[model samples]
Target chain A: MHIIEVTQLQKHFGDFKAVKGIDFFVEQDEVFGFLGPNGAGKTTTINMLTGLARPTAGTIQIAGHDGIREIKKVQRIIGIVPDESNLYDDMSGYENLVFCASLYGIKKQEREKRARQLLKQFTLDDTGSRPFKAYSKGMKRKLTIAAGIIHNPTILFLDEPTTGIDVESARQIRTMIRSLNNQGTTIFLTTHYIEDAERLCDRIGFIVEGRIIKVEETQSLLQEAQREHIVEFKVEHLDEGVIQEFLQSFNQIQVPRISDQTIRISSGRPIELMPYMEFLTSHNSKVLEAKLVHPSLEEVFVHITGVEIDRLKKEKEGKK
Target chain B: MNYRLMAYGNILKKDMQNYYLKPPNLSWGIIFPISWTLMFFLRSGSDVDIKAILPGVMALSILFGTTSMLSVTITFERKSRSFERLLLSPISLNLLMLAKTTGAIIFGIINAFIPVLFASFFVDLGGIQWTLLFSGVVLIAVTSTFLGLFIAVSVNEVFEAQTFSNFFRFPMVFLCGLFIPLEQLPRVLRPLSYLFPLTYGADILKFSVNHQASINRIVSFAILLLYAVGLFLVSTHNIKKRWIY
Candidate 1:
């Protein structure tokens, strides 16, 4: 069963179309990543799904209820951890959690118990009495996530949960996310962190310019990248002219370049490394190391999105 | 309905604990009114009727406390994005507004009563009718709170909310018969005074203190109730329209 189903979901902000008719569904207990650059409508889509923003056009069904008409039903089943840690600043961490629980209609005693459990689980037990505004960025993020799950929601929407935090805290949050998925909660996460998506998402949808360019299983997407084979050879006393001449002789090899005694070759098909090694050795060059380089998820994303990962990363940082 | 009520209670409790209980807010709501009443007593010559002005002081307290507190609380939450959490909850919007307005109303009533309590030490309270006074205070508090909600939801920033509140509040203070008798006002401004909810509250209080109401008690109650309901609907509608993106 799909926990979230969005069809032709669109959102327009005045003259700009933020999310232009995107469609996707997240299966039950799946960690679905929505990947995009800044201002690419990833947040707009999440807002529509979570009922924080009205869709200009399209339909959304969350856990068997119409996302618009039956929003209360959807709200009861879904927990949203917004990109901002927006709990009441004046309230203590424990108070924020209990308040969130109370909003979900948890009984007073149960709210207290659940709040305590979440604070401990988030490694915030010692700081539960501290006002939220006094918390460090990492602590606030942890507390926000804890509050999101205070009622044990069936589905959790985490928007850039690991962004702008200490490395240790980000790792801890990732572990918590994996654990939550293991406990049968459907996770819909939107992030600019390619590694987080590659590691946590069962499947990822690449969105660019308010459109989903592709959605595929993580492994499948990586496997599809195998169409291009890259082999890098390090040679002692390398002669660039001779290597270029030899590489030029093979029409199948494309974009071969020598940099600092290392010859990199790209081919549509897997190259026979034995012939390349023999060619280098015969040319008064000693082959030191040769290794095949498999494309990373970051590479696959760059290739699919037609944008450099660094450029996108810069854009995300600039937005922050 | 019950779940919504639970959400309302939770919101009200949280607001009270976080915003209303703060020292600055406490002083503004309670101490400010008492201080203002004392100022009035000090300035009043022997010819001034202290008993006649008591209700007006109480009405002013409700006005200032309810409008300022609600505006500040809403603006703070909205700026911090904490208010978004309330919107994301399963509770009905109406219930959320009710909870917020009701919190302000409770604080406003307490604010109004504090001055009265202080006044009783210096002024005789025997002539006042307790039932009429209580009812009028409740109605005024509710109306003022609803107005505060309307202003808060309409504006985006704390300063804007306060400015808008003042735009409404200062005019009401001058025209609501709080200081000047309604009949003493010029013919043109008399109708304008009736437009302010504070006018009815002042009228009710004047009658309660003097034991002779110029306006029928039933009529005053009904008009104030109507104002409360109308303002409540407008504020809730504005919240729904403006809150979501």
Candidate 2:
């Protein structure tokens, strides 16, 4: 059964529409990623699903409860970790988690036990006694996620789970997310990192300009990206003469660029790597390495969404 | 325990820690009332009877203490975005707001007694109506906390909350018969005085402490209750309109 079903969901602020009637669904125990650029209504849609924002139009059926009319019932079964940490800063991390669990009607002893287990799970056990404000960004993010799941919610909504944190922490959080989903929790993840969706998500939805452009299985999208063939050759002491002659020899091949002893060749059809290696060898240019490159989810995302990879990379770096 | 009560207790506990348990806030709650008492004596120069001004001072103490704590805490939480966590919990908006305001209501009630604590040392409190006194203090706390909630929802910044609280608080001090009697005020301003919730609260305190009141006891209690409910409804509406979406 689908864990979440949203239809024609729209949110408007004044005259501007933040989410322009988007529809999507998350299946049980699957990681459904809503990937988009900044201000692409990813967070807005998540807010509507989680019962934080009221929709201007359409319906949300979450776990069989009307999200708009019966948000309180839906709230009990779901958890939310906002883009920013919403846990109390003045309280200890442990205190914050226990308090959040208590809001779900967990008894005192059970909440304490769960808080301890989660603190250890998130590698925050040692610093659990410290105030939330004193923790580092990564620790704070981890604690916030821990708090979100303190009651072992059926579905967890994470907004930018890995943004603005250290690399090691981000990796650990991704691992934790995977572990949670493996344990039968449905996850709705919205992220700026296409790589995150590539690695963690089961199905991907591409949203642009407040509208969903595409929603497809990860493997299917990657397979479609494979239609374009690319080959890269790492050569030693590569010069302009080699590239000019190499292009002249292979007219169907397009040499995208030559930089740092590497030449990237692209074509609609597969190119024979041996011919290129022998051609370079005959020209007295030593070919160090040559390999066919598989297209990444990022390539598919760029192809479908039409947003330049450079712009997305800058947004990711700026977030970091 | 029931889940609703559990949510209420947890929210109330957290807010009490953030709003009242801190040393600075605790000290401010206690010291502000005492300071106001001292200032009253210092300004009136020794001949002014403590009993004559006790109702006014007690009403002022509850007004300042509750509004200051509740408004600042609400605005600060909203600014830091921590309030969203409470808003998203599996509790009704009314329950959540009640839990949030209970801490400041308790703080205001405690503040109302600080002046009485000082007054007990100098005067005979044998004839004071203890039932009326307790009822008056509670109603004042409830009304003042709701007023704080109103101010908190109406503004975005901590400073703005403080400033907005004063916009109602300062005017009520003069017009509510806290320091001056309602009869002594200009005829044109007396109608305005009745509009403030504090005016009825001050009257309740006066009847309780001095055994003298201009308005009927039932009318004062009813009006104060109405104001409390009215302010609470308006603030929650504002929160739903502005913060939820």
Candidate 3:
């Protein structure tokens, strides 16, 4: 079932159109990731869905309730972890969770119990009543996540969930997200952590310039990005003409390269790889070593987007 | 929990927490009000009774506590970025402003009156009316607190709140006869004093304890109450605009 349905939503900041009539739906208990370059209106769209930013035109429904008309109900049903948002500075980490819980009209005794349990789950314990101002960035992020999920909403919307944390902290956060997803909570996360998305998200929507370029299951998207592969192999020697005869066994094979007594064979499959290696071995071709490489998500992203993500990130940072 | 009451009580607790957290500031705040009350008692001792200065000293402390320390508190919150977090909470903008303002009133009352009661034991007032004096203290504290809240909302920054707060703050004390007698004011400025809510607050205080009731004294108290309500409405409007958009 679609828990969040957004259609023809448009938001224009003065003359600049931040979101231009985009459409998408997040389904039940599925981990969905939104991938995009920095200026791609990912935040603008997410803010609209979270009711922080009102759309100029369109309809967004959260569990069959109008997001604009019934914003309070929409807010109640979705827990949002906004990028770079602040926790209450004067309160302790435990107090921060209690404050958010009180906003939902939760009883204090229940809130205190839940807060203590969440603190243990995050492996966090404050020395005393240390204010949030004194907390490390990772601790603050963890506290915010605990606060967001305290009410146990049907859907969780996380934006750039691991932006500035250390690698160890990021991994811990990823593990926590996986646990949340396992418990039947629909996770709709937008992130620059492509590796996490590729590893954890069941489906991903590549958003760019206020549009969803492609939305597919992660494995299918990777397969679609790389239909054909060029395999490179090295051997001690090769007979060039006979290799052509051996290549005819497959649907497609490139002529082998023999340079400095090393033979390199190009093919789509490693199974096809064994056959070529066999032929070269029987022909008195001295086989030294072979390794198979699958195309990575970074490479796949570059192929589909036609631009390097690292360079794009640099340019966006420079502009900022 | 009654969420509204919880919010109000929590806000009050935070201020008390803030107050007790820094012992030096608390000590200084207590001393500042006490010293002012004593200085006024000594300076105007011969010319007028201690009762006249009784009102002066109380109004003096209320003025300084509400205008100076309260402004600094808001500015401190702004500088620390704590104010933004308050804005994001589900509490309405009006309650947030009310919480802070009401907190100031509580502090102002303690800073203004405790010294007066303590000093009253030192000097005896013959046939003085204690009932009217207490009522006057209530009115003056209310007006002073609302004035501070108005300044916090009107100023663009916390620093600006301090600068502009003094523009109205210092004059209200003098016009209300905290130092120079209201009768000694140039005839022209006396009428101007009538325009100030503090003038009525000061006189109602003087008449209630000293048995010097005038028809004009009653009118000033009514006007002072109106000032309190007006400032509240304006501050609430400003906070509402901040949240809605």
Candidate 4:
């Protein structure tokens, strides 16, 4: 079932169009990833869907409620975990969770019970009594997510859930997202990390500069990515001259300069490794290691959105 | 309706814990009243009767306590993005904002009494009208709290909130007939004094404590109530216009 159906949604900030009349739908119990570069209107689109930003023009129907008109009804069934941790700094983890549950009209006893359960589920039981301001980045993120789900919302909107957390915490959060999806919570996720989309999202949408370029099943996108053959060669004594010579010799393939001592060649057709290996060896470029590169969602994102990989990497660095 | 009430109560309780019960705010609540009372005596000299300045002291206490509490709490939460959590809740914006301001209102009311408590030790309290005093205190607290909410919503940073609050607070302290009577002011400034809601609030406290007021008692209460409602409506409008986007 289509739990969320947005049509020609638009959000304008003065002359800049943040979300320019885009359309999309999310199915019940499916994890949908909205992937884009920074300033690509990913957060703007989520804000519109969640009723934080009123659209300049469009229609949004969530769980049969008009997103703009009956927003309170829509809000009742949805959970939002903003990019920042928005829980109270003075309150404890348990207090924050219980307080969030109360906002959803949960009974006091039930809210306390649920808060305890969520603290345990998020592995925050040990630190439940500690103030949120004292929590580490990962624990703060965990508590914020727990607060969002305190009411057991039918759909959860997570914006950059794992952006700045530790590796272990990010992995645990991913596991929890999977578990929540398994238990029939529809997830609408927006993320900077393409790998997160590949691992957790069933279907992915690529939004760039306020326009959604493509939305497709993850498996299908990966299949399209598989059509291209790629190989990375780690070498010594490599330079711009050697790269030029290699590209000139192998005119059928495109060699992207990986580094001074490494190069990656990709093409639509299968690459003949022996000739390229022999040519590099004759040029005094020692090929230390060569490996076949399997395309992932990162490659698919680049291919579909046409955004530079360096730009995305720069966004990660800037966020960190 | 029941669910909304529950939501309101929860928001109120949480804000009370977060912004009101903290040691700084608790100390502030106690200290502001004492300081204002002491300042009144120092400015007017020790021989000035405490009863004559009780209304001004109470009004100033409520104003400073409420505005100071809200200036920090609201702006800090907004900066931290915690206010967005309340904005996204299932309750109506009106209810959520009212719940957020209720703590400050209560704090202001309590702050008003600390001065009165100090006065009762020194003055004979038999003839004072308790009902009128309570009504005046509640109105002053509500109006002052809504004024703080107005200032808080207008600014983004806590320091900006403090600065902006002073832009209103210090002006009202002088112009609202808190320390100076309206008739004693220049004729031009008397009209200007009437522009401030605190003017009506101070007048009400005066009528309650001294049985003397420049404006009629009914008009003072009505005007004070109107200002409270007006400030609240404008603040909520600001939130919808600026904060939501």
Q: Which segments of model 3 are wrong by more than 4 Å?
A: A6-24, A32-60, A63-80, A88-91, A126-131, A200-223, A227-308, A315-320, B19-21, B38-49, B67-85, B125-147, B153-157, B175-226
Docking class of 4: medium
Considering DockQ, which of the candidate structures 3 and 4 is the better prediction for this target?
Answer: 4
Cα lDDT, all candidates: 0.86, 0.90, 0.71, 0.89
Per-residue lDDT of model 3, residues B1-245, tens digit only: 77656766676667667653357656765787678766765776755466656666677777777666666776667555455445544456577677777767767777766666666677775566667776777777778877777677666577798889889877777776656677788888888777777777877766765565443766877888898888788766765443232
Q: Could you give me the TM-score of model 3 versus the true structure?
A: 0.73
Question: DockQ of candidates 1 onward, in order?
Answer: 0.59, 0.65, 0.13, 0.76
Candidates sorted on lDDT, descending: 2, 4, 1, 3
User: Mind giving the per-residue lDDT tens digits that candidate 3 earns over A1-320?
Assistant: 99888899998878988788888888889999888877888888887777666788999988899987776676666777877646667678888777667655567798888888888888776522578778887877888788888878788888888877877778889999999999998999987767878887998887777777777788887776465454555667666665656566543664334344444444454445677677778777767876654665654554445445445456435532
Tens digit of per-residue lDDT, candidate 2, span B119-173: 8999888789989999999999999999999999999999999989889999998
lDDT of 2 by residue, A192-267 (tens): 8888998999999999888999999998988887887888888886778877888888877766555657776777
Q: Compute fnat per model.
A: 0.78, 0.79, 0.11, 0.75
Q: Candidate 1's residue-wise lDDT over B6-30, tens digit each?
A: 8898899888887788898887876
* Residues B1-63, model 4: lDDT tens digits: 388999999888888877799898889878877887787678878786899888998898899
Q: What ranking of all candidate models by DockQ puts the best one first?
A: 4, 2, 1, 3
User: What is the fnat score of candidate 3?
Assistant: 0.11
For all predictions in the order shown, the interface RMSD in Å is: 1.0, 0.9, 3.7, 0.8
Candidate 4 DockQ vs. native: 0.76
Tell me the TM-score of each prediction against the true structure: 0.88, 0.90, 0.73, 0.93
Interface DockQ of candidate 3:
0.13
